[model samples]
Target: MRNRTLILGVTALAVAVTGLAAPSFAARDKMTPEQRAERMIKRLDTNSDSKVSLDELQAHMTANFKAFDTNGDGQISADEMQAKRQAFRDARKAWQEAKSKDGKERDAALAQLKDARPAMVPGMRPKAFKRVDADGNGSLSAAEVASASEKMFKRRDKNGDGVIDAADFTKKI
Candidate 1:
Protein backbone atom coordinates (compact mmCIF):
# COMPACT_ATOMS: atom_id res chain seq x y z
CA MET A 1 0.00 0.00 0.00
CA ARG A 2 2.92 2.41 0.85
CA ASN A 3 4.65 1.54 -2.45
CA ARG A 4 1.44 2.27 -4.32
CA THR A 5 1.14 5.70 -2.68
CA LEU A 6 4.81 6.58 -3.51
CA ILE A 7 4.30 5.55 -7.17
CA LEU A 8 1.21 7.77 -7.44
CA GLY A 9 3.07 10.74 -5.94
CA VAL A 10 5.97 10.36 -8.37
CA THR A 11 3.60 10.08 -11.34
CA ALA A 12 1.79 13.24 -10.30
CA LEU A 13 5.08 15.15 -9.97
CA ALA A 14 6.15 13.99 -13.45
CA VAL A 15 2.89 15.13 -14.98
CA ALA A 16 3.17 18.54 -13.29
CA VAL A 17 6.71 19.04 -14.54
CA THR A 18 5.76 18.07 -18.07
CA GLY A 19 2.83 20.47 -18.06
CA LEU A 20 5.03 23.32 -16.88
CA ALA A 21 7.56 22.81 -19.68
CA ALA A 22 5.10 22.27 -22.54
CA PRO A 23 4.20 25.93 -23.14
CA SER A 24 7.73 27.04 -24.08
CA PHE A 25 7.94 24.24 -26.65
CA ALA A 26 4.55 25.16 -28.04
CA ALA A 27 5.39 28.89 -28.32
CA ARG A 28 8.60 28.26 -30.20
CA ASP A 29 6.83 25.97 -32.67
CA LYS A 30 4.07 28.47 -33.45
CA MET A 31 5.98 31.09 -35.47
CA THR A 32 6.06 30.28 -39.18
CA PRO A 33 8.80 31.47 -41.52
CA GLU A 34 6.49 33.99 -43.15
CA GLN A 35 5.53 35.41 -39.78
CA ARG A 36 9.16 35.73 -38.81
CA ALA A 37 10.01 37.53 -42.06
CA GLU A 38 7.09 39.87 -41.63
CA ARG A 39 8.28 40.71 -38.14
CA MET A 40 11.77 41.48 -39.47
CA ILE A 41 10.43 43.74 -42.21
CA LYS A 42 8.23 45.55 -39.74
CA ARG A 43 11.19 46.13 -37.46
CA LEU A 44 13.49 47.44 -40.21
CA ASP A 45 10.80 49.61 -41.76
CA THR A 46 11.68 52.46 -39.39
CA ASN A 47 9.48 55.06 -41.08
CA SER A 48 6.40 52.85 -40.92
CA ASP A 49 6.34 52.86 -44.74
CA SER A 50 5.78 49.09 -44.90
CA LYS A 51 8.98 48.72 -46.92
CA VAL A 52 12.73 49.13 -46.42
CA SER A 53 14.51 51.61 -48.72
CA LEU A 54 18.22 51.98 -49.46
CA ASP A 55 18.33 55.03 -47.23
CA GLU A 56 16.77 53.07 -44.42
CA LEU A 57 19.17 50.20 -44.95
CA GLN A 58 22.11 52.56 -44.86
CA ALA A 59 20.79 54.19 -41.72
CA HIS A 60 20.37 50.86 -40.03
CA MET A 61 23.85 49.73 -41.01
CA THR A 62 25.32 53.01 -39.79
CA ALA A 63 23.65 52.57 -36.45
CA ASN A 64 24.87 48.99 -36.16
CA PHE A 65 28.41 49.97 -37.11
CA LYS A 66 28.40 52.68 -34.50
CA ALA A 67 27.26 50.17 -31.92
CA PHE A 68 30.05 47.78 -32.86
CA ASP A 69 32.65 50.58 -32.73
CA THR A 70 32.02 50.64 -28.93
CA ASN A 71 34.50 53.44 -28.23
CA GLY A 72 33.10 56.08 -30.60
CA ASP A 73 36.24 55.71 -32.73
CA GLY A 74 34.20 55.67 -35.99
CA GLN A 75 35.77 52.32 -36.86
CA ILE A 76 35.21 48.77 -35.72
CA SER A 77 38.56 47.28 -34.85
CA ALA A 78 39.53 43.60 -34.50
CA ASP A 79 39.39 43.92 -30.72
CA GLU A 80 35.84 45.27 -30.80
CA MET A 81 34.64 42.54 -33.11
CA GLN A 82 36.34 39.87 -31.03
CA ALA A 83 34.71 41.22 -27.89
CA LYS A 84 31.27 41.00 -29.48
CA ARG A 85 31.91 37.45 -30.67
CA GLN A 86 33.18 36.43 -27.26
CA ALA A 87 30.11 37.88 -25.55
CA PHE A 88 27.84 35.93 -27.87
CA ARG A 89 29.78 32.71 -27.27
CA ASP A 90 29.76 33.22 -23.52
CA ALA A 91 26.02 33.84 -23.45
CA ARG A 92 25.43 30.73 -25.54
CA LYS A 93 27.63 28.66 -23.26
CA ALA A 94 25.84 29.92 -20.16
CA TRP A 95 22.47 29.13 -21.70
CA GLN A 96 23.61 25.60 -22.55
CA GLU A 97 25.00 25.07 -19.09
CA ALA A 98 21.75 26.17 -17.50
CA LYS A 99 19.90 23.51 -19.48
CA SER A 100 22.40 20.72 -18.82
CA LYS A 101 20.15 18.83 -16.48
CA ASP A 102 17.43 18.35 -19.09
CA GLY A 103 18.38 16.80 -22.42
CA LYS A 104 15.29 18.02 -24.27
CA GLU A 105 15.66 21.52 -22.87
CA ARG A 106 19.36 21.63 -23.77
CA ASP A 107 18.62 20.54 -27.35
CA ALA A 108 15.90 23.14 -27.74
CA ALA A 109 18.15 25.89 -26.35
CA LEU A 110 20.96 24.87 -28.72
CA ALA A 111 18.69 24.87 -31.76
CA GLN A 112 17.34 28.31 -30.90
CA LEU A 113 20.85 29.67 -30.35
CA LYS A 114 21.97 28.29 -33.69
CA ASP A 115 19.06 29.93 -35.44
CA ALA A 116 19.69 33.26 -33.72
CA ARG A 117 23.38 33.55 -34.59
CA PRO A 118 24.20 36.94 -36.11
CA ALA A 119 24.13 37.05 -39.92
CA MET A 120 26.75 39.80 -40.21
CA VAL A 121 29.75 38.47 -38.28
CA PRO A 122 31.37 36.76 -41.26
CA GLY A 123 31.05 39.98 -43.27
CA MET A 124 33.07 41.79 -40.58
CA ARG A 125 36.17 39.69 -41.24
CA PRO A 126 39.43 41.08 -42.64
CA LYS A 127 38.73 40.34 -46.30
CA ALA A 128 35.30 41.89 -46.07
CA PHE A 129 36.74 44.96 -44.32
CA LYS A 130 39.20 45.38 -47.18
CA ARG A 131 36.36 45.16 -49.68
CA VAL A 132 34.33 47.76 -47.81
CA ASP A 133 37.26 50.11 -47.18
CA ALA A 134 37.31 50.94 -50.94
CA ASP A 135 40.39 53.23 -50.77
CA GLY A 136 42.61 50.93 -48.66
CA ASN A 137 42.25 53.34 -45.75
CA GLY A 138 42.23 50.51 -43.16
CA SER A 139 38.94 51.85 -41.77
CA LEU A 140 35.41 52.42 -42.99
CA SER A 141 34.03 55.87 -43.67
CA ALA A 142 30.37 56.92 -43.93
CA ALA A 143 30.68 56.88 -47.73
CA GLU A 144 32.16 53.39 -47.66
CA VAL A 145 29.30 52.23 -45.43
CA ALA A 146 26.73 53.70 -47.80
CA SER A 147 28.38 51.96 -50.72
CA ALA A 148 28.31 48.60 -48.95
CA SER A 149 24.69 49.18 -47.94
CA GLU A 150 23.81 49.89 -51.58
CA LYS A 151 25.18 46.50 -52.59
CA MET A 152 23.22 44.75 -49.85
CA PHE A 153 20.08 46.66 -50.68
CA LYS A 154 20.31 45.63 -54.32
CA ARG A 155 20.80 42.02 -53.40
CA ARG A 156 17.93 41.98 -50.90
CA ASP A 157 15.56 43.76 -53.27
CA LYS A 158 14.98 40.50 -55.11
CA ASN A 159 12.16 41.72 -57.34
CA GLY A 160 13.91 45.07 -57.89
CA ASP A 161 10.95 46.95 -56.46
CA GLY A 162 13.41 49.49 -54.97
CA VAL A 163 12.40 48.50 -51.45
CA ILE A 164 12.64 45.42 -49.29
CA ASP A 165 9.38 44.15 -47.88
CA ALA A 166 8.11 40.80 -46.75
CA ALA A 167 8.05 39.76 -50.39
CA ASP A 168 11.84 39.83 -50.38
CA PHE A 169 12.01 37.11 -47.75
CA THR A 170 8.77 35.16 -48.14
CA LYS A 171 8.21 32.36 -50.65
CA LYS A 172 5.07 31.81 -52.64
CA ILE A 173 2.73 29.24 -51.17
Candidate 2:
Protein backbone atom coordinates (compact mmCIF):
# COMPACT_ATOMS: atom_id res chain seq x y z
CA MET A 1 0.00 0.00 0.00
CA ARG A 2 2.83 2.35 0.79
CA ASN A 3 4.51 1.55 -2.49
CA ARG A 4 1.28 2.12 -4.36
CA THR A 5 0.80 5.47 -2.71
CA LEU A 6 4.31 6.51 -3.62
CA ILE A 7 3.78 5.37 -7.19
CA LEU A 8 0.55 7.33 -7.50
CA GLY A 9 2.15 10.40 -6.00
CA VAL A 10 5.06 10.16 -8.41
CA THR A 11 2.69 9.63 -11.29
CA ALA A 12 0.70 12.70 -10.30
CA LEU A 13 3.87 14.77 -10.26
CA ALA A 14 4.84 13.42 -13.67
CA VAL A 15 1.37 14.27 -14.90
CA ALA A 16 1.67 17.83 -13.64
CA VAL A 17 4.99 18.47 -15.38
CA THR A 18 3.93 16.65 -18.52
CA GLY A 19 0.63 18.45 -18.56
CA LEU A 20 2.18 21.89 -18.09
CA ALA A 21 4.85 21.21 -20.70
CA ALA A 22 2.25 19.80 -23.04
CA PRO A 23 1.03 21.67 -26.08
CA SER A 24 -0.99 24.53 -24.71
CA PHE A 25 -4.33 23.26 -23.45
CA ALA A 26 -5.99 26.00 -25.47
CA ALA A 27 -4.58 24.55 -28.69
CA ARG A 28 -6.01 21.13 -27.87
CA ASP A 29 -9.53 22.47 -28.28
CA LYS A 30 -9.03 23.23 -31.97
CA MET A 31 -8.03 19.66 -32.75
CA THR A 32 -9.62 16.37 -31.90
CA PRO A 33 -7.93 14.02 -29.44
CA GLU A 34 -6.64 11.92 -32.29
CA GLN A 35 -5.05 14.93 -33.88
CA ARG A 36 -3.48 15.94 -30.62
CA ALA A 37 -2.04 12.47 -30.21
CA GLU A 38 -0.61 12.64 -33.68
CA ARG A 39 0.94 15.99 -32.93
CA MET A 40 2.47 14.65 -29.73
CA ILE A 41 3.95 11.78 -31.66
CA LYS A 42 5.48 14.20 -34.11
CA ARG A 43 6.80 16.44 -31.39
CA LEU A 44 8.24 13.54 -29.43
CA ASP A 45 9.55 11.84 -32.48
CA THR A 46 12.93 13.57 -32.19
CA ASN A 47 14.78 11.58 -34.84
CA SER A 48 12.30 12.80 -37.45
CA ASP A 49 12.38 9.53 -39.36
CA SER A 50 8.84 8.74 -38.08
CA LYS A 51 8.66 7.12 -34.66
CA VAL A 52 9.13 7.61 -30.93
CA SER A 53 11.80 5.33 -29.54
CA LEU A 54 11.78 4.42 -25.87
CA ASP A 55 14.99 6.41 -25.55
CA GLU A 56 13.17 9.50 -26.76
CA LEU A 57 10.46 8.94 -24.20
CA GLN A 58 13.01 8.54 -21.44
CA ALA A 59 14.89 11.60 -22.60
CA HIS A 60 11.74 13.68 -22.64
CA MET A 61 10.67 12.53 -19.20
CA THR A 62 14.11 13.03 -17.78
CA ALA A 63 14.37 16.48 -19.24
CA ASN A 64 11.02 17.48 -17.80
CA PHE A 65 11.88 16.04 -14.41
CA LYS A 66 15.18 17.84 -14.44
CA ALA A 67 13.40 21.03 -15.36
CA PHE A 68 11.52 20.93 -12.07
CA ASP A 69 14.43 19.69 -9.97
CA THR A 70 15.66 23.26 -9.67
CA ASN A 71 17.92 22.45 -6.77
CA GLY A 72 19.74 19.77 -8.74
CA ASP A 73 18.47 17.08 -6.40
CA GLY A 74 17.37 13.72 -7.72
CA GLN A 75 13.86 14.23 -6.33
CA ILE A 76 10.98 16.64 -6.53
CA SER A 77 9.63 17.34 -3.07
CA ALA A 78 6.59 19.32 -2.01
CA ASP A 79 8.76 22.41 -1.68
CA GLU A 80 9.92 22.12 -5.28
CA MET A 81 6.35 21.64 -6.41
CA GLN A 82 5.23 24.70 -4.49
CA ALA A 83 8.08 26.71 -5.99
CA LYS A 84 7.00 25.80 -9.52
CA ARG A 85 3.38 26.61 -8.79
CA GLN A 86 4.44 29.93 -7.31
CA ALA A 87 6.41 30.77 -10.44
CA PHE A 88 3.35 30.20 -12.57
CA ARG A 89 1.24 32.30 -10.25
CA ASP A 90 3.77 35.14 -10.34
CA ALA A 91 3.75 35.15 -14.12
CA ARG A 92 -0.04 35.10 -14.17
CA LYS A 93 -0.20 38.04 -11.80
CA ALA A 94 2.19 40.11 -13.85
CA TRP A 95 0.22 39.46 -17.00
CA GLN A 96 -2.98 40.32 -15.20
CA GLU A 97 -1.57 43.62 -14.00
CA ALA A 98 -0.64 44.62 -17.54
CA LYS A 99 -4.10 44.16 -18.98
CA SER A 100 -6.73 46.85 -19.39
CA LYS A 101 -10.23 46.78 -17.94
CA ASP A 102 -13.64 46.61 -19.62
CA GLY A 103 -13.14 44.25 -22.52
CA LYS A 104 -13.33 40.60 -23.48
CA GLU A 105 -9.56 40.39 -23.10
CA ARG A 106 -9.73 41.63 -19.56
CA ASP A 107 -12.46 39.15 -18.72
CA ALA A 108 -10.33 36.44 -20.25
CA ALA A 109 -7.22 37.57 -18.41
CA LEU A 110 -9.03 37.63 -15.07
CA ALA A 111 -10.10 34.05 -15.57
CA GLN A 112 -6.53 32.89 -15.12
CA LEU A 113 -6.70 34.19 -11.57
CA LYS A 114 -10.00 32.40 -11.24
CA ASP A 115 -8.56 29.18 -12.62
CA ALA A 116 -5.51 29.23 -10.41
CA ARG A 117 -7.41 30.44 -7.34
CA PRO A 118 -7.92 26.98 -5.94
CA ALA A 119 -4.19 26.52 -5.96
CA MET A 120 -3.64 29.88 -4.34
CA VAL A 121 -5.67 28.98 -1.28
CA PRO A 122 -4.65 26.31 1.22
CA GLY A 123 -7.11 23.69 -0.06
CA MET A 124 -9.69 24.39 -2.71
CA ARG A 125 -10.46 22.48 -5.88
CA PRO A 126 -10.28 24.76 -8.85
CA LYS A 127 -13.57 25.88 -10.38
CA ALA A 128 -12.65 27.67 -13.61
CA PHE A 129 -11.33 24.63 -15.43
CA LYS A 130 -14.26 22.54 -14.21
CA ARG A 131 -16.57 25.15 -15.68
CA VAL A 132 -15.08 24.37 -19.10
CA ASP A 133 -15.00 20.59 -18.78
CA ALA A 134 -17.38 19.13 -21.36
CA ASP A 135 -17.84 15.57 -20.06
CA GLY A 136 -17.75 16.28 -16.32
CA ASN A 137 -14.88 13.87 -15.84
CA GLY A 138 -11.69 14.48 -13.83
CA SER A 139 -9.79 15.47 -16.90
CA LEU A 140 -8.85 18.80 -18.50
CA SER A 141 -7.97 21.06 -15.62
CA ALA A 142 -5.44 23.91 -15.77
CA ALA A 143 -5.13 27.65 -16.03
CA GLU A 144 -3.86 26.93 -19.52
CA VAL A 145 -7.43 27.17 -20.76
CA ALA A 146 -8.33 30.01 -18.46
CA SER A 147 -10.52 31.67 -21.04
CA ALA A 148 -11.82 29.98 -24.15
CA SER A 149 -11.85 33.19 -26.11
CA GLU A 150 -8.53 34.57 -24.89
CA LYS A 151 -5.96 35.04 -27.61
CA MET A 152 -2.51 33.55 -27.25
CA PHE A 153 -0.21 36.55 -27.15
CA LYS A 154 3.04 34.80 -26.43
CA ARG A 155 4.92 32.29 -28.48
CA ARG A 156 5.26 28.98 -26.64
CA ASP A 157 8.83 28.09 -25.74
CA LYS A 158 8.41 24.74 -27.43
CA ASN A 159 12.09 24.37 -28.28
CA GLY A 160 13.20 25.05 -24.72
CA ASP A 161 16.13 27.19 -25.80
CA GLY A 162 15.79 29.20 -22.59
CA VAL A 163 13.50 31.68 -24.22
CA ILE A 164 9.86 32.14 -25.16
CA ASP A 165 10.45 32.60 -28.88
CA ALA A 166 13.16 35.23 -29.11
CA ALA A 167 12.96 37.01 -25.79
CA ASP A 168 14.49 35.48 -22.70
CA PHE A 169 11.71 37.17 -20.76
CA THR A 170 8.22 36.73 -19.41
CA LYS A 171 5.33 39.05 -18.47
CA LYS A 172 7.54 40.76 -15.87
CA ILE A 173 7.37 44.06 -17.65
Best by lDDT: 1
Q: Which ten residues in a row have the lowest lDDT in candidate 2?
A: 144-153
Report, for all candidates in order, the number of backbone clashes. Answer: 0, 0
Error of 2 at 70 (Å): 1.0
Report residue 18 deviation for candidate 2 (angstroms).
37
lDDT values, one for every candidate: 0.74, 0.49
Candidate 2: C-alpha lDDT: 0.49
Q: Which has the greatest TM-score?
A: 1
- lDDT by residue (81-112, candidate 2, tens digit) is 56667766875885577486666767766766
In the range 25-79, model 1's lDDT, one tens digit per residue, is 9989799777876876776788998899878777777777776677887776667
Model 1 deviation from the true structure expressed as Cα RMSD, one decimal place: 8.7
Error of 1 at 152 (Å): 0.1
